[model samples]
Target: MNRLLRTVFLTLVGLFIVAPLIVILVASVSTDEVLSGLPSGFTTRWLSDALANDQFQVGFAYSIRVAAIATAWAVVLGTSAAYAIHRFDVPGKSLLRAVFIAPLSLPRVVAGFCFFVLYASLVPAAYGTVGGVAFAHVLLLLPFVVSLVGAGLANLDPELEEAARDLGATPWQAFLRVTLPRIRVSMIIAAVFGFLTSFDEVDLSVFLMPADTTTLPVAIFLRLQQNQDPVTSAVSSLMIVGSLALTGLVALAARRAGLFATRKERM
Candidate 1:
């Protein structure tokens, strides 16, 4: 009975998570009256129209550029921060860790507003620039990379690094040869998640956006204010499909790296 209940619960949870995506995907292809019923007719025209839109094209390009820059910076800085927090006894270490992860503690709208005020007041040059959006995205992504990389560091056996040191490897060489290789999967996770977070960001990016240049998410949001366009559904469908594919790849990579051991494997 307990096993049956567990299976049922899991099925419910999975359905809850997937139902929305399924609805959106179906709506994307439906020619009309999705709110009334299932698709009356199937058409790929909406998808084609979204692609042909000049604003969406520009927004897509802009989002990619910003997300790339944000992910690169976040992974570099967050990895270094995680390493230092784990590997050293620096002063104010607890405070530093709190600061690094603090971004997640605030409501996203509040964070966005705070950044808006900061740039508007002191850093006028950065306001309404790609650099501004990228910087905010780094802050948003810092906690994810730091937490994941720190977990990876914790799972390492210290003796391996010590053995490398005993073999006369310099500290850098020992780290590169021993520690860095082990945490590679974690880094990949950080990059993938960070890129996705930056790309899909709307609430935060909206505040920092330039008048002329906007991210894809921001463009989608602005269009949403105007009307419920079929193009929106089609675009969302593409993003949903792409994101699922990317997540599957990440999961496969993690499993191969021994991060997702099966129950029998654990035994």
Candidate 2:
């Protein structure tokens, strides 16, 4: 009875999550402009139109660029911070961890507003620039990277790094050769998370996006504010498909890199 109830609950939850996606996917291919009711006919014109939109194209390119840069910075900085916190005894370590992860608890609007206020006061010129927006994205994503990579670091064996050092490797060499290789999966996961988070972030991006350089999510939001159509659904569907494809590619890469071999063995 308990197992049946659990299965039923999970099925409902899955349906709740996936129903909107199904609607969007269907609407993306619908010939009808009104998406409130059933779709009239199937067509790929909306998808084609979305792809051909110059604004969407520019926004997509900017989003990709910013997300890539932010992901790289977040991974590098978050990994270093996580490694230090996990491997060393630092004063105020607990406080530091709390500070690092505090953004996760804050509302996105509040975070964006705070950043806007700070930038407006300290660096008004950077308030709506691409670099500034990217930096904000990095800050927003850093906590996820730190948490994921820190978990991996916590699970790692210190002996592996020590053995590398004993083999005449310098501290940097030991970390690069031994520690990083073991945590590569976590790094990849963090990168994926950061990229996706930045790409889909609307609240912060809306505030930070410049007039000349908008991100995809901000563009989508602006479009929605102006008008709603099947084109919006098509764009959203493409984003969903893109995200899924990226995740699959990352998982395949991890498998090829032997990151999952131990788990497979245990299973």
Q: Which stretches of candidate 2 lie over 4 Å from their true place?
A: 263-267
> Candidate 2, residue 138: CA error in Å?
1.1
- Candidate 2 Cα deviation (angstroms), residue 123: 1.7
Least well predicted 10-residue stretch by lDDT in candidate 2: 204-213
TM-score of each candidate structure, all chains considered together: 0.92, 0.95
lDDT measured at residue 220 in model 2 versus the true structure, 0 to 100: 86
Candidate 1, superposed: residue stretches over 4 Å from native: 250-267
Q: Residue 259 CA error for candidate 1 (Å)? A: 8.8
Give a tens-digit lDDT track for model 2, residues 171-255.
Answer: 9999998899889889989999899999899998777757667998888889999899889999999999999999999999888
Clash count, candidate 2: 0
Predicted model with the maximum TM-score = 2
lDDT of 2 at 165: 82
Q: Which ten residues in a row have the lowest lDDT in candidate 1?
A: 30-39
Q: After superposition, how far is residue 22 of candidate 1 from its true place, in Å?
A: 0.9
